[model samples]
Target: MDKSPDAYWKATLRLIGTVLVIWFAVSYLAGIVFAPALNSIHLGGYPLGFWFAQQGSIYVFVALIFWYAKKMDDIDREFDVHED
Candidate 1:
């Protein structure tokens, strides 16, 4: 099956939008906005919120980077545009 450029681009854009939303929620909402509430929780003797602010988000970001690359490859293959 073949995909038009418009459809492929739309898929790419949607993937980007989804990744951005996830990144924002983890980095901003969890790390800062909800930090106070999350402070009640603990991980390895440190506040969960603090962990998120200092380290968790970075880990999540790196994971997302890999996930995004994998997803992009999948999308490219689906659209028959992937490099071999």
Candidate 2:
């Protein structure tokens, strides 16, 4: 099946939006809104909430970057838009 450029761009944007939402939730909700409750749990030497704010979010963001790249590559292949 063939996909139009518009469809491909929309799919790409949807993937990006989903990734951003996950990033926002981890960086903001867990780090701020739910911090006190999460603080009860420990990770390594820090409270879980603090860890998310300081380190966990960064790790997740980096992982997401790789994940996004891989997904986009797959999407490009599916759309027959991938570079050789």
For each candidate in the order shown, give its overall lDDT on alpha carbons: 0.95, 0.93
List the pairs of residues colliding in candidate 1: none
TM-score per prediction, in order, is 0.95, 0.92
Residues 1-84 of candidate 2: C-alpha lDDT, one tens digit per residue: 549998899889999999989998999999898999999999997899999989999999999999999999999998999998
lDDT of 1: 0.95
lDDT of 2 at 45: 75
- Give Cα distance to truth, residue 9, candidate 2, Å: 1.4
Q: What would the C-alpha RMSD of candidate 1 be, to one decimal place? A: 1.2
Where in model 2 is the C-alpha error above 4 Å?
Answer: none
lDDT of 1 by residue, 1-84 (tens): 549999999999999999999999999999999999999999989999999999999999999999999999999999888999
RMSD (CA, Å), each prediction: 1.2, 1.2
